[model samples]
Target chain A: MSVLDRLAPELITGAPLLVMQGIAKRYGPVVALEDVAATVWPGEVLGIVGESGSGKSTLLRMMNLEDTPDTGTYTLALPEVAGNLFDLDRFARRQLCARRIGIVYQNPHQGLLMGHSSSGNVAERLLVAGERRFATLRARAREALDVSEFPLNRMDDPPRLLSGGMQQRVQLAKAIALEPALLLLDEPTTGLDVSVQALVLDTLKRLQRDRAITMVIVSHDLGVIRTMADRVMVMRRGRVVEEGLVDQVFQDPQHPYTQELVHAKL
Target chain B: MPNSERGAMVPGAVVLQVEGLAKSFQMHHLGQNLHAFDHVSFTLRAGEFLLLKGPNGVGKSTLLRTIYRSYLPQAGHVWFSHGAGRTDLAHAADVDIALLRRREIGFVTQFLIARPRVAAEDIVAEPLRKAGVAAEDALEQARHWLATFGVKRDLWRAYPTSFSGGEQQKVNLARALILPPRLLLLDEPTASLDVGARAALVARLADLKAAGVAMIGVFHHPGDVAALVDRDLMLMAKEVDDVAV
Candidate 1:
């Protein structure tokens, strides 16, 4: 059964899934972000592209509640929670990050418990949420693995035993098992072999479509962004220099930096 | 990489992306600028072969040199996938470029630059020898490459300077393929070769493609290698932008 069938029918706010304003962050004297504002509507895929130091990642981390903006306010905008995510108690923010959001990193090692069985990795989230039945855990994890396109027989293998692409698939499986309202991907296909990258991206594109899941993807590769995002934001020196429909920004960028970046891509 | 332009790209680590690369030369005496190639941009994943096609003097050779850092670009960046990260070739340090040349990158041109008195075998073996392979073993490997490229064994001990045009081009190709670099840049490598030898080189390149080597090649006649090319970069002729000297 799909994991969505197991949801407890929690109330979701009619407001946009995310709302942030005047976000600013700095490391020592170096400004990492400045007055960045963004809003992501539910079920919309927003692509973030930038050079290495362009604050696109810093912005994503803030959205995931992994990093906090020093000046601006941003929140999950859940109907149940009236306060910004940072203002909540540490435990509350952690709970929201864990239950309501899913994240995939470029390296699966960062997300997967390497030594744990693939099924163990996927069930860990469900277990943490207080599910105690072994059969249910196994079943749900199996279903998630199916959606991830991972070979069902390999479910018992540890991520350490899987190929780089397969380990990434396991990460996708674990992330989606939670049925997160927001999925955050950071360079999801950056390091895989070219042939394998195509497969993983195909799987990701399919998963996103099947679930109609909201995603905010941060990738340096424009080709990666083009495949999945409807809208894109180009960031430079920690500020959003351009934002528009992906085609418009790529084909006819108003900002010169955006133009250079677009044309610079293959 | 065939359908990569349509949005789905290969899953391998990106091996090369030449970004907005442009090159031109300043004629000091004439006080005019001569543009080679401009606005050149393309990306290659490992194992992809990109054929650079253009009219004479459109700067296909210049574009290759700019990527190799033989000619400094007039504009743009060459982002080469270096290990887990990437290097902008246009701004990379000479020492770094030197190391990359010895390890990950290889270049081949139409003319063979043979040193005086160096035997054809030793010339092909030079790269492996410098990489610390035993001299005898390096030469043995060199002979294997030479044979694969259709070079006659009788020429093994002879100096390449005395070889025919086709023979020298074969020797040049053998030397470049000796190391099987991750990124190979070819500048009209088949220009000096006869039909049979050109076919030999093309067959050898097909083998390299299967071994996952990325290549950027300039060819006047791409018909023979068309089967191996993943993308064709058509460089249009550029109008010289005369600048104040």
Candidate 2:
């Protein structure tokens, strides 16, 4: 069965939780992104697929506010905030990201604290969200760990002690512990084995179904896009070559670039 | 490959044998004794990659250090079989251990400890120089490894102390692998490396294993190097017995 068929039904009727328009970014001498537009609805998974230097990661960084767009109107349906996200100051952006967004990097270690225990890593997000009581933090950490299928007994062990798959699970647990409104995953399974990749993807799918979390996944792996994305955005050289339903894009890619990508994988 | 197939490839003789290995530390201020591990025993074969798996503070590092003679085991024998003969690293004299290290062992740790003014290339070539290799040849090999690890040509003459953590780690790996020792001990060698560098290191390690260099490695992310592992040695807390897979 196709991946989207196994997940919870999409809630397409609701207003989009995020919207971006006219997003453009430029590095010192090169244009990293140009005129990119997208919408992420609640309870939806959007996958961005492209090769290296395609600006998919740059777009993700902008969505997470790690980098500002040179020109764009970005809006997040965050409670008590109605202004454009691009207008927020650095400190405000950091605070909003900490409390409202969860991000998992391509390298699991980048998203984790190597010196801290698994439980400590999970609890850190809660603490950042102003959770002070140890009992409360531990309880929330255990709940998140359970959702990620992390071994409860190994909670006190640091990330260095865990296997690659287990370390990715800890990263997932830490990201979801705060119950962020938006989740950003950047090539989450790029460096893992096929079996381990399947496990990580399954866990992510389960979390999406159970929590109804909105996510933006960026990957060059077509399999990951096919399995996890409800909608796929095909990008090349800083432009969106094609955007459509995952099945539609896979079965009948319109653009030549998208067709080439699909054919190469087949 | 299955463990049996690996064992069959190197028949009859073990590369490293550890028996009754034990170590403990005394906390003078707290007035407590901590035993790292007790009565641990294992056998590693030539061309084998043994992955050490365990929780933090479980003595994986301690066991490796003891085997390398960096830490003196309270009681044990680390019999490393070499071309000449077997040497007991656990009880060997300092000078003998030093000599054996030069020719038989290559250890890569997380940190690099180069002299303040030493250039990156020279730091990597120091081991070969000590082994009496010509300076020009050693530097050439060093430059080759630096390029393989993705260290830029401009950084070859720069001091490692001024390099980034990842750059320093590449230099450390290049230094350790220059001589192709009989036994290699790696402690989180890829911890500080980027994705490209990690892949390069993994490929290089695979070549070394195929060339019959026995290795024991502790990895923070074992998945990156999972293909090379032939067996697993799991160290647990003092209360539980260590498990060998």
Candidate 3:
């Protein structure tokens, strides 16, 4: 049985938390993303599958608001805000990002502060969200670390001293400390050893199921997408070629490019 | 012996012999000595591939470095059999060791240290040039290996220092394998490489094994190299014994 089945059945259900339509982005002469549309429902896990330079990362960056979609209606349904994200001013978008989004990059170093202690790294996210009390910050940080299964004894150790897998755990803890509604992961286990990759994936699965946090994970590894994603989207050359339930797509891929990808994995 | 499918007969005589290998470090701040390994012994035959397995901090990497003569072992002997003669790498003269390294031994580490302004192709060809191959011939051969490792032809002229970790690692592998050394020591060679690059490396290593090159490699994921490895060496952390002052 899938690990997700063991956790409390996803309790959150409502209108999709995020919606994008006709998203298009370009870098000079290069078309990075083109008319890509996706909807992430509350408590859903969406896996974006594509090789390098396939617009998967571009779509993710647009969702994170790191890059604005040149043309599209990007909507994030947060309690306090309801409108196209690209329509917001930079300052307003930044506020919404701080409040509602958590991102974990493929490189753990990019997501983590190597100089700060592990717990300090987790606590810093809360501090940025305006939590000032030391006791509360410490408590929340410890809780997040516990959820990620990071060793509490090494809470004071900087990330540089930790192994690659441990550093990823710390990054996961820090990203989820704020309990954001949406989590964005880009090739989270790409470089980790197989055993360590299993651990990180297990932790992510447990957290996603228990907390019912929505997620969009991008990876070139079909194994990762097969294990983690509830729905799968396949992109090729800056456009979505296929999208469907994970089982449906895996069993009978409609797009020729997706069929080639699935065959390569097998 | 794992009975590798390669079934290539290893040389009857051992290519490398180690006895009573021990290494330790003095932790001055902690006022204690860290024992890396103790009384380690092994023999590697020509054309045999040995996989070193152990957890972190167990001295697997330290043992590899000591064999390469980069790190000094407190007490041990590493006898490397070469065409000229058997040289105790543990106690070899500096000049002899340097010459042996250039001609007989090659080590590939996880990271590459490329000099600034040097093109990737030149970096791969440097070893051959040092060994007295013509620059043109060396570079031509370097291009062949670079292409084998899947490095784009256009990037061959650019500096490797700016390449991504996987790309630089491919360059490092090309440089080490270009000369086709008698004995190769690899530490996590596939750590940074992608699936395609890794498969390419495995294929190249298989070819080298068929050609009778002995190797000792440390792999975090042994399954990746299982088809090539003939034997396994497991290292355990040594318990530190307090020396009474």
Model number with the top lDDT: 2
- DockQ of candidate 3 is 0.01
Model 3 CA deviation exceeding 4 Å by range:
A1-13, B1-245
Docking class of 2: incorrect
Give the per-residue lDDT of model 3 (tens digit) for A143-168: 99999999999999999999988988
Error of 1 at A53 (Å): 1.2
The alpha-carbon lDDT assigned to residue A52 of candidate 3 equals 96
Clashing pairs in 3: none
Please give the distance, in angstroms, between residue B159's alpha carbon in candidate 3 and its true position after superposition: 49
Colliding pairs, model 1: A192-B11, A192-B12, A193-B11, A193-B12, A194-B10, A194-B11, A194-B12, A195-B11, A197-B11
Q: Model 3, range B112-196, lDDT digits (tens) per residue?
A: 9665556899889988776667879989999999999999999999989789999999999999888767788999999989898
Question: Per-residue lDDT tens digits of candidate 2, residues B153-229?
Answer: 99999989888899999999999888777789999999989988899899999988887788999999999999999
lDDT of each: 0.79, 0.82, 0.81
lDDT of model number 1? 0.79
What DockQ would candidate 1 receive versus the native complex? 0.01
lDDT measured at residue B213 in model 1 versus the true structure, 0 to 100 = 81
